[model samples]
Target: MIAVLRTPRFLLRQPQLGDAELIARYLNDYDVAGNLARVPYPYHLSDAKAWLRTRVPGLPVEETNFSIELAGEGFAGHVGFHRGPQGPIIGYWLGKPFWGRGIMSEAVEASLDWFFSASAAPVVYSGVFHFNAASLAIQTKLGFTETGRSTLLCLARGAELEHIDTQLTRSVWKARHT
Candidate 1:
């Protein structure tokens, strides 16, 4: 079983097969998918099923997926890290109804705490589409510095778009939170 990380308003739990339906419901929304780089528009139940089947709890934190669940509600979104071209990059998105609630910020902090505690990597990177201001703000508030920019394919947008790359090092993270 995966360990659960709790905050005041949310629980970051390992993604499970049972969550596929709820995951599909939230991800099918254009507003949610558009902000994500990999999620395809018109997301389907099959997509969620396949995605959930891949999440293995015992893996390193960088490869584990967390389903952001509200205290009383079901799945609200997702946050996790994957092996990016340069290093381990974190990524996340919320259901449209849950947007603007600062939930992602909390979820990310909890995830990063777990990640930095478990991994030896000195830095974690995240890239946001130029249009995703809310995400940019969340990363900025988390102490990630702007590293650079590049054009990347947006599966949802169906084109390559300019992305702002940002990174947070272990030393900076420790210093700020100390």
Candidate 2:
């Protein structure tokens, strides 16, 4: 277990095996599956088991996967900051049941704060698909600026021809937090 990252109505923390069932629900949603290249539409229990084995939660928030918890529920969605040699990347998805509720935004803010405060990475980049307005809005709300665009041949869903690159730098994060 890790120290919790608290928001007014949510808690961002390391994930556990118990969260697999709920996380499967979120990953099975096309809205989430389509944008992310790794998720398969028909997410399965085995997939969840493999995910748990990846040990995303046991590592630092800046280097591992984490869960979005909504008070009573243990996990609402998946949100995490992953580190690379260059910097960190943002990856997240909310259960369809929890969409349209501003929950993801709060979770993103909390995660970004954790990343900037804890890691050596100077920035965090998020791959926001052009059609995903909610996700783009979430990035903007967190002060991520439009950096550029990318085209990925997603293994799960073929080519995503309209992916936009968005990023938030340490300087920008510091400016906003101050």
Candidate 3:
């Protein structure tokens, strides 16, 4: 089973069935879904349910996803990693209501700490759509550096968009945290 991770402001845990409603509600907003490469626009509860049902625990760290939960407010967003063709890629999203509060930054940092501690991967990969300045800012702040650019299909946009590829090496992350 995936162990729950705690931060000062929130909890990062495996996605639960109860999170479906909030996940759908948040992703339904184009502002949120549009930034994500895989989430379709007009996200529905069924989509959330189907996605949640697929989240199996005991998987490798690279395959696990975490739901970000506020103390009393419940599901706020998600942060996790998945295996990409090149390496392990990290991804995250926060509800619009939770935007600009540094919530995602905290969650992502904590997730990375847990991730690096739990695995032997030397680097983590991530990227943002060219238009996603806020998300890019969060990543850069956490020691990620741009590697290049390429287009990826944004399901919400129904088109491929320029994606800024980035990577955070274990040495860099360690330097920052130390």
Best of the two (1, 2) by TM-score: 1
How does each model score on lDDT? 0.89, 0.78, 0.94
TM-score of each: 0.96, 0.90, 0.98
**108-168 per-residue lDDT for model 1 (tens digits):** 9999998888889899999799999999999999999998998888887898999999999
- Every candidate's CA RMSD: 1.0, 1.9, 0.7
Which number leads on TM-score? 3
Highest lDDT scorer = 3
TM-score of 1: 0.96
**Candidate 3 has which clashing residue pairs, if any?**
none
**How well is each residue in 39-74 modelled by candidate 2, as lDDT tens digits?**
776788788878887874457656666688888766
Could you give the candidate ranking by lDDT, starting with the highest? Answer: 3, 1, 2
Q: Which runs in model 2 stand beyond 4 Å of their true positions?
A: 56-61
Off by over 4 Å in 3: none
